[model samples]
Every structure is written in structure tokens, then in C-alpha cells.
Target: MTAARSSFGFKDVDAREKVRLVRGVFDRVASRYDLMNDLMSAGVHRVWKDMTAARLNPQPGETIIDCAGGTGDMARRYSRMAAAVQARRGGPDARVVVIDYNAEMIAAGIEKGSAPEMVWAVGDAMKLPLPDACADAYSIAFGIRNVADVSQALREARRVLKPGGRFLCLEFSRPSSEWLRQAYDAYSFKVIPTIGELVAKDRDSYQYLVESIRRFPDQPTLLRMMREAGFGQAEFTNFSGGVCALHHGWAV
Candidate 1:
């Protein structure tokens, strides 16, 4: 008889099991996720996210899907920006949809009442349930690294986007300066999990967070992957001395 399979995040787990384990981590950390992020990044993550939004340059009457947009931060920002653009242009009808695989995350977003223009839903990035050419823009903020199959998720993002739709991903990346890299690594491996223990009371999840960031592909590699996924032009800009990177591309 065959032995039973273990789950993902376990050394013995198969691919599918790994995906489940990763999803479970987010679900477990949903409520305190934003707090942990602030604690871990010392509130610098907000600056990084704001920089990412600035690059997106949301316009009026456009639809955006923020894949893995936990707690609806990105969605809320985009909706507001779009609304402001509409106000200036004398037109209305812009929306931001926040989709995350974890229901707990969606619940938190809904409870927070992110924005009336923001819609929260539970969905996976790898296989979005939306129709083709539906979104004018797509973004995944600080969440793609946790995905079981990142390449597949990028493809799905491309598939759901309209021609000329923009794609942006803001994620943890390799630090540029040697000193900063060493310091960041030390903080991620040690200080982060310690903060998680004190703040979220979930050190294991925080430890996994550091591991997942270390395991993610670097900026250039990710840009290449995006191009391979059929993005017309792919490029990236590093932030925080390379502790984070923003990758942007467009469907053609």
C-alpha cells in the first residue's frame, strides 16, 4: 500500500499539498497580517506600496483587479486614485476588485470597509474565475511569492487583462547594497519572526515568511518570467535600496 501524502510547507509534501499549506498560513495570519507587516518593515512597507501605486497611474473609468490584495490596501488606494481622476475629468465608473485566496483575508478587508468602490472576493491567482479581457489593469502586491506556482499566476493575470492592460507586481527583492542586504537578511531571519511572536503570536508563520522571501526569484529573473508570460514589455525599479522591487509590464 502507498503511504499517505503530507501537506505543503512540510518537507515531505507534494506540490498540491505545498500550495494548501501556503494558503493556510495566510488564512491564519489574515487579521494580524497588516500589523505584522508594519512591525516587520518598521512601517516602510507603506512607503513602498505608495510608490508602487504612483507608478500604476490609475485613470478614470478603468477596472483593476488586485490579485492577492489582502486587506484591500491596494484596492482601496487604486479606487481612491481612480475616483479622484474621475472627479477631475467629470466622469465616474472606476472600480478596484481585491481578490485573495484566503477567505479570512477577504473577511478582514470587508470588515474594514476598505472603500465603497472596492469589491472583496476569495479567489486564487493561479486560476482566476474572471472572464477574458475583463480587467484594464492587474497587480499583485507582496503576495505572489507565497503562490505555489508563480508562473501560472502571471499567465492567468495576462489572460484576464485587456489588450494594453498593465500589470504590476510589488514584492520583496534582493537588497542592492551589501551592508543593507546583510542587515535586511539578519532582520528578516531573526527580528521579523521575533516581532511576529510578540505581535501576532505566530512565529512559525513569520519564519515561513522570511523563508518564502529568500526562496523567491530575484528582480531580473522575475522580469524575464513576465516577458515569457506574454507581457509586451517588462521592467522593474528597485526600492528601499533593493529590499523591494516593482515590476511592470503590459499585455499587447
Candidate 2:
């Protein structure tokens, strides 16, 4: 039997090969990953991230895992928010863990230095390192599409969360408006890769990134996947007219 095929941007690749290819993509962009984010979305990604965190609303004593959490951007936000809640409520401090398959991305995140509450590990979205029912919340921002097995990743997320644990994902999605989709497509295809070339000096990597976004499942399909993966209940909110979407799931 042949192994399955996965999308590496618009290109179809052996499923087993995608992990290595995706790793290379992040390794090349790790150092300037945050910078390129600012350039690519003109800093709109920041607001989108904020919305993701707000939805999660890191609380006191909650163990939050940011899967494929490149450069610990979301983890840091979680740490701060969780700490604030702990301070006000007078309880155990929350743990914000950053897990990613790419070591270089983890290293870049470490270079920025995070709070003591933050823990960093190199791990896969499809097979996280933590034990079952260990986390109170799990989030992946713009990272799930890179996984060769998104369904497996969803199951792992279900596996690792305690009952009632929340799952949140924020990723680029198909726009609801035809005109906006056309404009976004034009910008994503022509401009983002060029920005990568000028800023990150790696056009091909950013090209793959944009393509991966296009390849990711849109809101409704992903919600169905979540429900099938044992998330009992799931829903999504379109951000910026569906240019991006934030998905929420509850492990029952």
C-alpha cells in the first residue's frame, strides 16, 4: 500500500515527506518570523491573535498549551493573561506551554525571553508530548494546516485535554465576499511572497505559507472535524469578514 498524499502549499507530496518540508519552512523563517508577520498582514495578525487569546481568556491555575506555537507569541500573551487572573484571584499561577515541531522556532521564541510561567517544548501537533487530560486549554494559531494529518492533530488535542477543556484555533479562511476574496487572493499570491523575499529573504517559504492557508479547511468543515474528533461541541467566528476565523471547541 502507498502512503497518503498531503498538500505542501498547492503541491501534493507524500504524507510522510510533509513533516520534513514543513519543518524546513519554519526553520528558514524562524529568526524573522514575527517581522514577516507584521509585514504580511500590516500588523492585522496581531489583532487577530489578540482575539484568539481573548476567546481563550487564560485564567488562574489553567494549563494552556499553545500547539505549533511558533516563537511563543501566543504563549507569552497567555502567560500574562493567566498571571493577571492569578494575581487577582490569589491562586496557583497558570502554566503556559509552547510546543512546536520545529526546534529553530522554539529557539527563536526563547531568544525573546518569556515569563517563568512559560514552558517551551519541541513537539508535533499530531502527537503532542504531554500526557492525556493534562491541559485545561489548547490553542494553535495559524499552525494546524502545516500538519500532515490535521485529523490526527485534532484527536490528539482531544486526547490531551481534560473534560470540559477548551480548544481554540485561529487560521486564515476563505472570505465570504467574492470581491474581498479576489483582492485577498491577489495580495496573498503576488505580494506576500514578495514581502518574504524583501524582508525575510525567503520567497519560497512564504509562498508555501500562503498556499497552506489556502489549503486549510474553511470554518464549517473544520467545525465538523472537531465535532467528529470528540469535541462534543464546537463553533467558529469569522474575523475580518472571514479573512481569518477563530474556532472554539469543548471537550466533553
Candidate 3:
């Protein structure tokens, strides 16, 4: 049988090796990850994240597991929403768990005070350290592309979510506009790494991140994967002319 192939940026490698490389990249850049995000996306990432949170519509007393939740951005946003609902309803506060395999990333998140009410843990997306049917919603933003086994991560997401729970992901995608795509490609391949070098002092990590986004599956392919992982009624909404996309699926 032919050997399995996995992507590490523009390079192909064994699946396990790819995981190790990705972990190393994150570990090296964890301290400045959030800042790099802002610089790379020109602050548009915050808008994308706000859109994701709006769609999630976190409710009072619900549990949200944010896998690969580096720096806990989504968790913090969700917690604020949940807290408001709880305060209004006079119920117990909702729970938001931010899990990532990179310990350094989790540490940075905790140090930033990413919502006093949320839980932060270092855990792998493909093998989440959560019980089955334990979460009311699951989310991963800008992190799934780094996973070595995207399908396994999707399966784990489905496993942890309760029946009728929601699965939401925000990720980079192919831009529909040819002109925009060309500009984005130039910025991603050139400006991003240069900024990483000047700011984060890690050009290689940024380069890998950009390449990984290019290697990620497009909108339709990811929906199919979610369906194969037992999610129902999977769909996607592109943002910024498909520069990014929000994918929603239900565990049924």
C-alpha cells in the first residue's frame, strides 16, 4: 500500500511528523500568538470571531468546549455572553473550556485572564480530554488546519457534544474573488512572515501557518468531513469574500 501523506505547510511528511512539527511551531510562537493574529489579519480576525460568537449564541448554564482554543479568545467572548444571560435569568453561570495541546498557549491565555469564569486546559483536539456528550457546544477557530488528522478531530468534536449540540468552526478559506485571492496570497506569503520576523521573531512559524491554511480543505470538503464524522445538517458561511468561513454542524 502507498504510504500515508500529511502536510506541514507546503511540505508533505508522515502524519505523526507533521503533528510534531506543528506543535513545535505553536510552542515557539505561543507568547505572541494573539498579537501575530492581529497583525496578520489587520484586526479583521476580531470581527470574524465576533461573528462566530454571535452565531454560537451561547445560553445560560450551557457548557462550551473550545478545542484548540489558543489564547482563549472565543472562550472569553462566549463567557461574556453566557454571563449576561445568567445574570438576567439568575441562573448558574455557563461553562467555557478552552483546550489546546500547546501548554505555552494555554499559559498565555491564563495569564491574559481570558475570562475569570472559563476553564483553560492543555489538551489535544483529536483526543479531547472530555467525556462523551458532555458539552452543549463545540468550537475551534483558526486551529483545525494544524491538526494532523482533521477527521479524527471532527469525530472527537462530535463525540463530546451532547445530542442536538452545535459545532462551529471559523477558519481560513479560499477567496472567491480572483483579485482578492491574489492580493491575499501575496500578503499571506510575504507580509505575514515579515511581520512575524519583526514582531514575534519567528518567521518560520508564520510561514508554516500561511502554508497550512492553503493546504486546508475548502468549504464543501470540510462540510463533507463533518457529515462523515456524524454531524447533521452541516453547512458553511463564507466571510470576507471567502477569505474566511464559518462552518456549523449539529451533533444529532
lDDT by residue (20-123, candidate 1, tens digit) is: 88777887788899888887888998998888888888888788999999898888889888888888886767788899998889898888887767877889
lDDT of each: 0.86, 0.93, 0.92
Write down the TM-score of every candidate. Answer: 0.94, 0.98, 0.97
Q: How much does candidate 1 score in TM-score?
A: 0.94
Give the range of the ten consecutive residues with the poorest summed lDDT in model 1.
3-12
TM-score of 2: 0.98
* Candidate 1 error regions (>4 Å): 1-12
Give candidate 2 regions above 4 Å deviation.
none
Candidates 1 and 3: which is better by lDDT?
Answer: 3
If ranked by TM-score, best first, what sequence of candidates would result? 2, 3, 1
Worst 10 residues of 3 by lDDT: 108-117
Cα deviation at 155, candidate 3, in Å, is 0.6
Question: Candidate 2 residues 47-124, lDDT tens each?
Answer: 999989998999988899999999999998899888888888788889999999999999999999989889999999
What C-alpha lDDT does candidate 2 achieve relative to the native structure?
0.93
